[model samples]
Target: MKKLNKNQVYGFIAIAVLSLGVVGCKATSSVEKTEDKTVPEMFAGATKDTLNSGVISWKTYFKDAYLQSLIETALKNNQELNITMQEIEISKSEIKARNGEYLPFVGVGAGASVDKVARFTNIGAMEATTEIKPGKEMPEPLKDFKLGVYANWEIDIWKKLRNGKKAAVNRYLSSVEGKNFMVTNLVAEIANSYYELLALDNQLEIINQNIEIQSNALEIVKIQKDAARVTELAVKKFEAEVFKTKSLQFEVLQKIVETENRINFLVGRYPQHVDRSTGTFNDMVPNVVSAGIPSQLLSNRPDIRQAEFELAASKLDVKSAKARFYPSLGISAGIGYRAFDPGYLFKPESLLYSIAGDLMAPLINRNAIKASYNTANAKQIQAVYKYEQTILNSYIEVANQVSKISNLEKSYSLRTKQVEALTNSVSISNELFRSARADYMEVLLTQRDALESKFDLVDTKMQQLNAMVNIYRALGGGWN
Candidate 1:
């Protein structure tokens, strides 16, 4: 046997150490750009002393029992929301896969194979001359059987696999926030539609009452014509007005049907009557909303939080991609039994085992890795932009709803007085016409104005309620 001398052995060790140092020096870049994290102290000049409505639970926020029920049903059954839940599950599975990438993978397996060699080959001639035992010849064909447990693992020296798993975790949390945002919207939609249905019911009742009033006026005009106090044209005008009111009643009924169906759709059910308080629509007042500081939106709004998670995930993805440019160390091992025949597979003489490791690095044609790293960086930037946009949008939505609620309150008050005056005028005009003290045209106009004012009052009230629901949603309520 030959062996190396001490000097040669020292030189070999030095070369091995230099080789490790060269391979361990990664070429990946670690430069990351800064992101904006600024937010206003207040939203639409709101004071910081007020409490944010978003922290309130949906059950406490929505006082209407029917509306609360609808929201609950939607959260449980809405197709879009269910789909978002599935996406969350998928993200969770991705986390598992990434975690597995950095952990040892172990498995057991068994296999059998047969091999044949030609007599004219070198191995065939040697086999013909060989003897397995003193008087036995080697077999013409070989049969192999094996059974083993094997394992492979990639050492995450640079935290690449760990970062990938963290990214998946972030994405999973983002999906949860996405579902919460959807809940907010769904609750708002159902409430809005429910209020609209109530408004339509009120409008329909108003139209029907107006139609009866016009019919009586028509009767009076016909009586006046019979007495030669008015011409046929006046009677015909009153009759046409009655027909118009009846037609309007049908239109309002159609709206009611559509609104009910819309609510049913939101609740993920078939079209049917939506339970609501139709008579109380006029008495329904908008809920008082308190706007907290704009900075609170970071924690209050689900979309904002979702964007935040997505940004975090993207940042982690960039780290994982950058790590790809460095060398990766992998180890594999197997313990097994192998023999030329199945009878000998489990014997101690057939026992076999092996272990190996490799260090791999991109030394040539690294365009693919560079592109992936660049793409990860770009996505991180995009996530930052999206995060900022979500915050901006949340602030604007709350501000707009706040203004809308204030304006609607004033408008509704004015409309109430207008309705009262027109209603009185309607009665006065009818009495004057009956006594031949006012023109038939004046009576008709007063009745029409009064009916319209009543409808407007209902519509304004509906707007007030809708504004309240929207503000709650904007503040990220109904998702807790």
Candidate 2:
């Protein structure tokens, strides 16, 4: 083969460089550049204290031992949490796969083949005339044997492969943050359900007490009817009131069962009795929640952090996709031994080796690359919007909970007073009915009102507890 002269080599190099210049220009389009919105300095109508309750550990924030145990079990056994953990592992594997793409690929192999040529052909005519030895001609059909190691590497001059690996790394981090977000929700759910169970227990107890009170009043009406002081209609009204109050206990009991099963499902266990202390449910006070500053949510909330990581990954994806329009340099090399006879494969004369490099760019039919570039840009924008939305939602949630807690406090206080007044009125109504001054309907109404007020107080306390847990979750607590 004739070798190229210096001028020809230089000319070839110049042409190749020119071709790269023509092909490497990237497809351009407009994309919006956005920055995340700054959160408020403080939550709406909230204190400026920087003591964020979200920083508190779940074990420390939840003082109940039983609740802590349930949360611990769920963290270890919850099905959704376990599934999320596997997703994180899958993301990590993707990072490894992407990382490997930026590095060299190597392999070793062996192969055998047989080839034959017609004597009439030009290369076949030469082969028949040539002699491998003084009297021996080349074989008519040749057997080939080869063993070799080969390597390929793509030079990342444009950082395309590196950017892809970086994107994968960011996605892996996003998956981890997603797991943490799930943990926050799981902890909050179990705590809320636990409180609901306590509230149901208290409501049931109140129903049973009301039933006893109504039954005693019914006995009084029966005695009065026998004494000719009241009609049988009054006696029937008292009995019906007692039966109605008794039925309420069954409704509350069913709710208790369903609630317990919900909690059991979250804890990743079969339905069973949840161990709890119901006697102090009324006395249990909600923990003081700190909203801290709205700005803290960016770092504290897992969903926000997850979205941030996803946004970062999407930006890298755009870079990687954009780089696809640039020239890529690849090198491949092989070293091996080949021989017509298996016994001669290891001989020095049978050795062979080759190396080559190629530089390529998409010169035509680049619609796929353009589509990918546009899709990447769109995703990046989507990620930006998602990040902003998560932050806004988190801030609003905390604000709403802060306002709810304050209103519930006032409502609980008022309801407590109302319950006390109604309890006294029920007793007074009974006294007046015995003296024939008040009607049986008034006594029944007073008893019903007092019972309802007590139930409302329990529900209010449950809501207050739920708000506390919710705010903690909104602030991105519990995962730590």
Candidate 3:
């Protein structure tokens, strides 16, 4: 065995002392472990069907071809969706940047410089007297040239760099989930707006029909006034009813234009007539909705998943921050050749190489490290609360929609019967007025009631369709 040199023994002692210092250093303050709230097993007042509509493809769930086409266009061209896609790409770039931090950086470099020293100085006097050969002297006004490969690396002894990279990976996944959540919302908004446009079309049709009926009643009133069976006031009342109904049609027409424009905006284009089947608007029945178990929402809802990922990333951030209190290790090295003249640069006599290691720990003025650690802990807690809130919000939305669907179904059925009775009453009142058995006011009242009832029926059906779309959104459907 060879004997140990004093320099080597001293170097080992210095490393031991630094390692001890690292072990002795304590975090300024300890952080509490993060805890997340649990989700409910079942929704309130909901049957556990185990078959969530959220898993169904949007194309299959929404059978209307026009609506399907609109959603497809929005997914590709909607400005908001496109913007989120760019955010995802940005997050991807962050992941790459983080991944590069823990790895060694190696590069090559070359440089040239000229230097001169006074003759009275120590180096100048030595150069003047030194001989390169039997009669040769050192060169004056020296020109130095050098080339070398160099490397620098931070040793991740406490996993700080790796944790940062993992956190970035989680954030990238969170951004993707954010895009999925947007898709779900965009699809629902377009669908609800499409249904609203159809309702307006139906309302316009109803107004036109009512106008014709009122005009005919006005004519009958004129005949009665000629026969002296009714006064001129009765004729005027019928004429006013016809005018009012005619005005309503224009209002509905304006709404149709506005709703169509809204759909066009969502489709990322200029306003144009939206293609839809108004003929089936009244005949269309809302599909049955089934809400699966509440626990399934954790996996079904993209917002919830997004929050979960953010929580994971925040936890990793806390670990990375805490590592700041510990010692860091780094290594740097370079090897090449240099000489006064370029011709001697590659010679063995001119060879040069150096390597070194650094060990550092935060021993004083560590308030910044402490603050960063505390901030990371706070963000982790915030993420936990956000995760729980998303789950709760998803459950509440599904519950409300389920309740609304049941109530709206009952309301629609009753409104249909009311419309039927009011429609028949209009005919009865007209016949009685012609026979002088009912007052003129009675006929006008019956017509007004019938029109209002029919309007209510259409409005109820629209609400039913809207509830269906909203529940699908709340359950996190449409993204897939």
Q: What are the C-alpha RMSDs, in order, of all predicted structures? A: 2.5, 1.8, 2.8
Task: Compose the digit string of candidate 1's lDDT tens values, residues 1-480.
Answer: 789999999899678655654654554565566667677777764667558887889899888888888888888888888988999899889989988988999999999888888888899889889986799887668787899999999999889999999999999999999989988898888888888887888887788788888888898899999999999999989988998888887887888888888887777899888887745679986778897877777898999989999999999999889888777889999999997777778989899899998877776787888889888988988888888888888889988988898888899999999999999999999899989999999999999889989988999999998998998999888889
Q: How many clashes does the backbone of model 1 have? A: 0
TM, every model: 0.93, 0.96, 0.94
Give the per-residue lDDT of model 2 (tens digit) for 436-464: 99999999999999998999999999999
Alpha carbon lDDT at 260, candidate 1: 85
Order by lDDT, highest first:
2, 3, 1
Order the candidates by TM-score, highest first — what do you get?
2, 3, 1
Clashes of each: 0, 0, 0
The Cα RMSD in angstroms, rounded to one decimal, for candidate 1 relative to the true structure is 2.5
Please state the error at residue 468 of candidate 1 in Å: 0.8
Using lDDT as the yardstick, the better of models 2 and 3 is: 2
TM-score winner between 2 and 3, please give it: 2
Model 2 regions lying over 4 Å from their true place = 1-4, 116-126
Residue-wise C-alpha lDDT for candidate 3, range 256-351, written one tens digit per residue? 999999999999999998999757577998878788888888898999999999999999999899898888889999999888889999999889
Using alpha carbons, what is the TM-score of model 1?
0.93
Pick the TM-score winner.
2
lDDT of each: 0.86, 0.92, 0.91
